[model samples]
Target chain A: MRWSLLGTAVVLLVVFLMSQRQQIEVSYGQSPSSPDAVVEGEAGELSEATVPSVEAMTAMIDAEPVVRLPGSIARWNERVVREAIGDSDIRILVAPPGLDEAERGRVREVERATITIVGTKVSGGVYEATADAIPEWRAQFASGDVTTLLVPMIRHLQERESPAVDASFRWREPTAAELDTVTAELRANGSHVAEGATLEGVPEASEKAFPDAEALYVALPRQPFGQPVPRYGPALARTFPDRPIVVVYGSWIEYDGPGAADFAELVSAMFYAQFGTRLATYDYPQGNVLNAWLNRVTDVRYAGLFDRPLPYLPFDPVKVTMPALPWLFAACVAGFLALSARSLRRPQAARDSRHYSRLAGLTALAIEVSGLSGERSDPPLTRGIGKLRAATEALESGLPPAQVRTLLDDAENELDDTARLLGRRDYRPRNYLEGRLG
Target chain B: MSASWSVWLVGGVLLAAAGVGSTLVPRLRARGVRRRVAWSTARAAIDSAAVSRDACATRVAEAERLLARAESIAADRGGVLAAEEAARCAERADRLWRAARRG
Candidate 1:
């Protein structure tokens, strides 16, 4: 928890510092105030020269160089990069829904910034080297929207939520009452109007006012018959050819290895998704996060007093400027949390109190069950106690409870007494002797 | 026609794969660590896992060889301690040989 908190603090600090590009640039010997600092030719000193380390000849031969056998022994002495990185995971970009103005700018900024950062982190993001050079690299995809989407997509990866219409305003179409009200209000200023939903479309009608050229067609689609998959994509495409159609669909998010077989399978699977009428598909791949979110969804409920949008403040989703620092800070925070969780999960001899509690319960159970017949006039009390004790011992030794019970039963008949004791009065002593003799 | 083609193609490929896997399975098994003598750890560790009747004929022969050597050494003026040591060693060896052979 402390590690996660520290990680969060570090991420916030990164975000805060990154917000001010001035200080962040200084780390890489660049001054944000002077753009010329980035120029390779301009500098106080020419450049840093590579330095060579000198080692003693005797130390080289005498030293028992430890070689690491991967997945087995650790070699602190041997410091060499592994020749191959195991199992490269295929990265899927799932863009967050409906980017606010501020977020969109941040997206663009990150896209530009990734060109520099991607140069260092994973040289060639499997997409291309020099993020700017990715254009010349792709055969058909050149608009660079894919690269633009990757940054925020990777940073703010969330499971797909139900696609919803953001806002809807409704009015009874061509209502006589509504039209009368509109005309009464408009005619007071000496204006006339049609009795329809067109009263609200007054602002948009001046551009398409010719009655003979175009007819007002207000039609709603009938319910689909067979497949429930929304046919709205092609429907809208036919209705409005010039305007672009955006279709959204829910998808399972999971990680897939980058093997050609898996890649081909995914490609083939996507071909069938066309019948589902999805305009464009984006892989969300939040298996790790979705499980956690699902758990939260099941267990937790929110009652925040006000909206605390992560990237935005004050007036919501408006003419806002995007800041790059916050997103970077969030990334650092997430990384820190992940690392802390992974690191701290290491096992110790620390036992859970619940485990000890369970043991104590079973011990008490044994004490109660051991001498069950002791208080009564049960003759086979010692045998019963012995059996119970044996079962308890088996339990203590970690045998299955059922097996212990069975074993206890197996020893039961051998311990039962048929004859009565001497303490029992009422002419039972003679009878007890006879029984014993028999 | 398409369905049948797909079925036949997948079937042939799977059959070929199965044949190839069977051929390589033995080699892969052999590459692993060898088993111990007390119990079967992987595959064959001892000459024979199964023991016949009271004791193995081969185990008796080996035990006899060791006993014969100890006898010859004792013949050339052996001390009480050496004789006792020899007796203990023979007993342990014989016990192990018998147990292994029987097991």
Candidate 2:
């Protein structure tokens, strides 16, 4: 029985694991064509005439000034560039510090027409990289270009040395028009909006807006400058790691010159990084690929993100059914063991009863023989009966069977003598013979 | 699935395996114990019964021989009634011995 129960449990476990494997395969093994269509559809109708070759985009970037960003942002930018160019040879230059003259020569030797590195110089004890080659790389105030910007404001604040330009004094709350624009965009994208007094209130407001929302959509107030800040994104991400957060920036922010496209690309990448596939219908071609790939991977990881059981927190109670199967299996095993124990005990119990019955039968036999011998009125026979009765009492008192058997043997000898004497017709009592002779 | 859910699933499986092992191990031990006890009891009962049967067989043979001797003695004395009574007693003893052997 236990073996059968174990076999059933093993079968159930195997079936469950196989089903999970199949689900993983179905989700991750799908062809990229359907996603490509979805991506292209999201980008709107594009004519073949308007699509430029990868060579063209690389050439354009090489002619313009280099856009320097942190490694993470750079990687995201490269992905977007690849999506836009489609199989063209392109390379983004990354200039790490402490490169000697020999290493610099090596870099130049490897440099292709597609590569360009932004150089840095020390200014006022702080490292300042030159953005002069590209008009977009120039500081925003100097060029009056809405498209140009500096480092992520949060990183600038965290640095040991201050930047050449300070934008802290320029920080201000969003104007009513700016708020209206952002709120409209979010509403169009199917998000629940909750107004908060400050940036810190975003989480609480989101919670209040839709208590059972699967994801949180936060429309950040515009920065002092048109450029995006690094602090808000990382802060919100840290605060709510369990749920997906979508930070919506106002579309009215302008980007001028070569920096315009770069800034737009950066913003789109930020949205992708924060919310994965839910891009909120942003007007960018790269968003299609980014959203599609993210959708597949995230969907594989989180199988049911937006189903019933609203207010999807990090741990959804509905998805916690995995333990039940194993527990049921364990219960069956336990029950099987219990039955086996009972069965195994049965034979032992029966044996004990047989022992008791045998002992009882022997005692009854001794008592019956003693009663038959008692019919003779002889004193010796009576004495023997008394001895037999005592032995029977001893057996009933838990005496060893061997000792009781010895007592029965002695009693049997006495009974046998009484029977033989009774069989002799000529036998006489001693006292009667003496009286006759006198 | 999230890492927590995966952790929980693996932990649950391990726990169930442990439970099965715990239950099976003790039951197997108990089965061994019961088997040994039953085997010993059966052995003792067989031995005791055989001894009792042998003893009864001897008693039956002795009683038959004694009955023959008593009949001869009674015939020599011309006491037919005494021989008949002695034969009845011997027969009763023989029956009792047979019953004991059966037991």
Candidate 3:
């Protein structure tokens, strides 16, 4: 039993560790083709070394509507349009009202069919147009949702489409209370969003300010074509190794329009997307919004923005719930330990009882031998000796201590009665002899 | 089954087996052997008492009956107390046999 229990415990520990190792392998096994896939260029746009060609980007976008754009402004535009349109089959056409026919034609020629850059008059299957670019397009087609890359317009579109989708799905600028709730949730989930570390000035400032933060959230203002965006991700990662640096680059208007609420959600989505893959690791029951976003925009390449050790996930494992069988086995082990303990205890108790029985048998034999003639002459004497013998046998037969003790007691009484009849007071049983000797 | 689930299931079975096989079976087997040996010893002693011509016929018969009872207990594998009682029965029968032969 001892060996069994020890072996079982050891095996269980090994199995648990093996399972955890497998899970860890599944999570961190994939090595990215390159350690750093994306390198920021002079203007904080993707450098030529990292940026996908227009043809490749177009091909990828055609296959799956998600693409990691070259510039922060472009990604920001993609994020807004993608968020506003959601999982619906609607294609968002990004064309400024200022662009003329020749440029529009070139844009059309480049994109093929996924999203054509068109002038004011928009016509398509199902599409969303910026309110500023297409004022008359909505009047022409009642099937499309119009958004102006602003929170109010996005919120309006959401309100209009809320009935067809989940009513709770609202894409508006989060309030202060909402931001607090999200921040609290993130903290609970072991993600400390360094509040003031927006990387507005330099990466060194954030490193000094939020040294202990697990992740640095940098919301950079969009840089002009000539102006360089402050590349903070690499610098922040160097300052804090194995920590995530989320840099969401957006136009100044995008930041002011959607406000902290949307940025907070996006940051959280990206944070969880990088770190916590299992919902069991979190307190929440629902699926992550970021996972849904990734699934919807299936082909978005994560360009090593956060210095992630593992490649970006296709999607996180939903939830890992332990089976009932393991728990049952654990319970059985506990029960076995208990039974083993009882079994170990039983032998000692039985040995003690056996010792007493032996002494009693030997003592009774002595009394009978000494008074054999009296035992034969007197019927009660003979009967008492016989009863004593019976008691001893019963004791040997593994009766319970209490029952054997009772039988011994009865035998002792019978022997005492016979002793009285024989006018002798020295024939005491083993129990009395024990008490006297002790 | 998933890898983790398989591990758990296999581990659980091993634990249950260890509990039953290591603790329960050996203890029971030891008890059974104890009772059987003790009862056979008692019967042998009673048979020896029956062999002696000077032994009291009534006492010898009574001891033989006691030996039979001990045999029943041994067959039943009554436990530690029953084995002890069987041992005591054997001892008593031996005493009777010796006393009768001495006479």
Candidate 4:
């Protein structure tokens, strides 16, 4: 039974490990790839590197159409567009001023499309260039919901898109700590971020500031020091409801620590396109899988980020849970000894062995002899032994074993030698050589 | 049909091996290759076989060293992909050696 239990446990362990390997996901869109890109050159704005860049938002806007441009636009432009909000999985549609009823009336058209809104941080610049580029605000707290299904958009849908936000380099100092704080909080919660020694050869100050970033994740932002901002496609397919999708410039984000060699694996997990990374929607059950993957990376790569270590999964073989063998052996030996001592006794001469048995009723013979008149009975018994011995030897060897019995008076003996010996009978009675030969 | 008994019996043997301190991970990895070279090389000596005293001592020693080195490498720089792989390989080697030693 013990064997069966242990066997089952071992088999189960093997199967479990084989089936549940770890999964890792790399988050895209965080920092700019290089510092050089921040400085615009004669060619125009300095191009961002391949790292995913997040656009900033100044204020929220309602999903209402107010055409600022007077030029006649195409039918597609006039049609309602459904666009992604922030990182949320929410979608919003902006209808024309008087077309609210018409939009509701055209069920088929409404089914086909809705107005799209890009919930993003507007950079400071274009407002000063022209009134068309002036910033607008709305009281409605409009945003996207980044569900398993929908993705967020950080910018406008385009034919002729709006220009950049207006702000002078001298006066503009927009540095929101919210994005950094939220990311750090998640890493802390998941055990992915760790504190470690500073490394050399990093090209930016962030290298020292967040020196203890996940190795695989930190290395991503380090690649492509200077170039056009690499593409970060939309994270959602639709304007997801209430989810905040962060759109950073082109930069690599590490799931594991920088030392992780499987960054290629992270890249493989997502779909890449001109826009950005998209974590596509799957079946309802798959959200758990995604979360599980996140948990795995958090654990599997969580080693270096902290001083005190995390406890491992319950992978060690249960400490041979059965009672110990040595204890059992000790108990058995003790019991055996107890029984042996209790049963110890002298050996019985006339019992299992035929030689020992049938050696006359020695006690009965002695009693009968004592009852006999004035007889010590020793001599008679001795005589009986001689006769028995002589017969037995004669039968065994076809010759008389006792020379005295042959030379002297021979007894017609029916008794056996074994009985005579036990009774101590004298074979010779009062003869000159009495009892010598017997 | 219930050869569960065999597992227990084997477990006993394995326990004895562990108690006797013969497990080595590297040798286990090297097993079943090159004429099952690990087992052959690990045998302590023909003379020792007579009493069955650490018949695989030599291979066990070498395998242990390899496993330890691998473990050290893995402990540091574990975040990198290459480092992580090496660490896993080292862990495997150690486990294998331990199995062989136990066997």
Candidate 5:
């Protein structure tokens, strides 16, 4: 059983390690062709245009409707887009709006180039402008051209299509009393309260206020996105009802040290809650040792500009297949149980066979000793030999020891007399023989 | 879950099972061996005692038979003392046999 268990453990460990290796290889984007070879081939084509700076990439992301730009104009735009998104699972690619025929051709070329360079497949269609653009976007989505629309316009359209609540109201900063009331209400309903300027900043604020809170309540500005948009509070509340939240409409217009500290704590707490212990808190744009040390000391991670938290991409689910180990483990366990049962059920008489064998051996030895006395010719000795033989036979047949002992006593007396007649002074009686044998 | 996390979870469960099996299997095997040994020892003891009692009973029966024959011979010779002595010997043997059997 020990061996079986050990074997199963070892097999599982090996299989698990192999599966992890396979997953790592897949995640690292390792292809049949070397990465360097592909990069070098693409580099020559990209040498004519300089790679865009990080600031320029950020500008491109901020300016959503980049109209009528040639694909080759933004060399390595795909790389920039991927870097900006970090590790988000991008299922569909959306072309920038306002593309003429020449620009459209460039966009297609850019898409193909991005696919080739990344060595990963992506499918999507060009975004077309129309008088009825909402229906056009919906049509593209329904036709599966853009399977996962990440554009803010798509979110706005969805909100318009299914208005859950009317949140149209003038913007205003909340008072201290209002904040206190909201915080109290959230606490009453079993929530950890963390004050923030907007819904986007809550993650950072909650991290600062309570680093270990599983759920948190944060203040939401009346116009969080610079406009009277949808009522996200009720929807968020409904979605995470078990994780009750209380939103106080307010604005932290001015930044201060205390506010920044609170934001840092909230971000830390939110990240910890979301990922659990697997993730390490690292400084944003992590490279410098000094920054890492400072971040660690301050317990702060980058919460982003405008006090917005960084995007979080959860790890992909893992699928594992172990064809034989489970069956083998079950078989080993079953075998162990069966063997144990069989061992327990053995016959009691069979187990006691050793005692019978010992008794038989002792009786045979006694018979031999009597014959060695050399009183075979005497009638009394002959009678004693016959009686001893009878007793030995009875013993071999598992006869009662009391009867055998009685017969042995008589045989011993007769044998002793015969021995004396033969002048044998060394002859011992039955009691001494029985004691020595026993 | 991430691939590494999944592997660790499975490895933990397997290790726990292995630990349990390692602890329990040896104890179960020892218990079985001890039970079998105890059973064999008890059987041997009972059988030995029974045989000893049977031997005593046989001795008592032989003594009784001798007493009866001696009494018949003495009666033919008109000797009451010899018959009485044989009867006493037989009675004593019977008593001893009964005591051994009871034990």
Candidate 6:
């Protein structure tokens, strides 16, 4: 029974190891950040190394491309770059999401070559600000009626020319009604907007706007100047499954970017905004556009948070799942090895030959004694004697210890019956024997 | 796939194979050895018991039957112990026949 359990445990360990092996292969075998990796999306390949023509990008516009917006030019990983210019022909013109008015001027001055066309296109499915769109963009900037969105790209030319810029955007308080409308729009677009959800990192002034904390509580902390974008904690996301989370960078106040209401409005506005509208609508958790919208947006660039792809953040799978798989597989293999060693060390057989030999001796004596008595004359006794002899012969043959003992016991019973029969026949008194002799 | 990935996959498969080989092969070998030993013992005993079968016609006929059974057991698989027992029974039968003749 114990061996069976051990065998079962080994089998289970092997199964566990196999399961983890697949995950490990996926984790190490194919890196998600490889720029040359061609992922077959519903549209054409999502990871085109060379820039594609304008017509090609336009053809994929209706395919609902999923873009990865890097927090800044410096923070751009291959994954971010691969998603951005995978389909577009134009060169990337990058900047930090949140920038002050002075930094904006510096950015504009640094790139005088394309100053009129400041807003470059994102890769895959973003709006290509063509020669026709460039005039309108300049006109809008001059008019001051709308805040034009900046192009989402890596490698800012301004960073090469001027000193490093910090993330310090303008701040504004939003009304509670606007937050409600934003939440409603998110819900319509298949987002799980937890109403009255306790939002961490909200300023005290905006805390009253969200009074009740009935649902998932998300912490939208400010992203420091050059650090990577903030992602929702895996622990927090696991706690409230299916709750929508925003991977916030800086879409709020000047220091804080936008208020909680403003942040929500920006996220909801991205669903309809020209560049963000092409984002493939994902159900609930997978489709949360808050990260994608906030990673590109900053206060200096996107004064109107709703209209610009430049104002949004980027979100991706948390770092936890990919790294832990290799360790788990290793542990499972170790356990399997331990169990197998234990199983091997145990003895296989414990049958003793001397035990059967002893039983045979006892059985041989019983047969001899039974034959010595005159009980063989009786029909039943004769048959019993024959059976005892046969049993003795069976014992001499190399039966297993248990079966030999059982046969010996049966032979002993027959011998006892033969002895009893002899006792009864020999029960004559001494006096009666003397009288018969006289 | 990366060259390291092939290394890992091959390494894992080899590890699993080694684990199975290390634990299972020795036990299977021991069992085979035990069975062969039992068969050898049974065959020797059966040969020894066959000599006395022609001494007494009635008693020796029973010994012959037991020896036949033992031979059959030894010939087939996994019945070595039983064959040895049957041969021992034939030896006992020979002893009983000699005792009956002396009585």
Fnat for the candidates in order: 0.00, 0.00, 0.06, 0.00, 0.00, 0.06
TM-scores of the models, in the given order?
A: 0.12, 0.28, 0.27, 0.22, 0.21, 0.27
RMSD of each: 37.4, 18.2, 20.8, 31.3, 24.9, 20.0
Model 5: per-residue Cα lDDT over B1-63, one tens digit each = 355454456556655665576567767755654443333222232222233334453445554
Each model's lDDT: 0.29, 0.38, 0.41, 0.27, 0.38, 0.38
TM-score of chain B of each: 0.34, 0.44, 0.53, 0.29, 0.51, 0.73
> For residue A165, what is the lDDT in candidate 3?
19
Docking class of 4: incorrect
Q: Candidate 2: which pairs clash?
A: A147-A255, A147-A256, A212-A311
Tell me how candidate 6 scores on lDDT.
Answer: 0.38
Q: Which parts of model 4 have CA positions greater than 4 angstroms off?
A: A1-257, A263-294, A302-438, B1-103
For B1-103, candidate 4 gives per-residue lDDT tens digits of 1253344445555444433332343334323232222111111111112111222233655445555554454445333343434434443554454356357
Q: Please report, as a residue range, the 10-residue window in candidate 2 chain A with the lowest summed lDDT.
A: A140-149
Model 1, position A15: C-alpha lDDT score? 41
Give per-residue CA lDDT, model 5, range A2-26, as digits (tens). 4565566567656656764554332
Q: What is the lDDT of residue A280 in candidate 2?
A: 20
Using Cα atoms, each model's DockQ against the true complex is 0.01, 0.03, 0.08, 0.01, 0.02, 0.08
Q: What docking grade applies to model 6?
A: incorrect
Candidate 5 DockQ, CA atoms: 0.02
lDDT (Cα, 0-100) at A252 in candidate 5: 14
Tens-digit per-residue lDDT, A301-357, candidate 3? 223233434444565342233344355456546766676657555453354555485
lDDT of 3 by residue, B25-98 (tens): 76686776655544434443333333332335445665566666655666676655776676576556556654
lDDT of 4 at A407: 16
What stretches of model 1 exceed 4 Å from their correct place? A1-389, A395-404, A417-438, B1-103
The TM-score of candidate 1 is 0.12
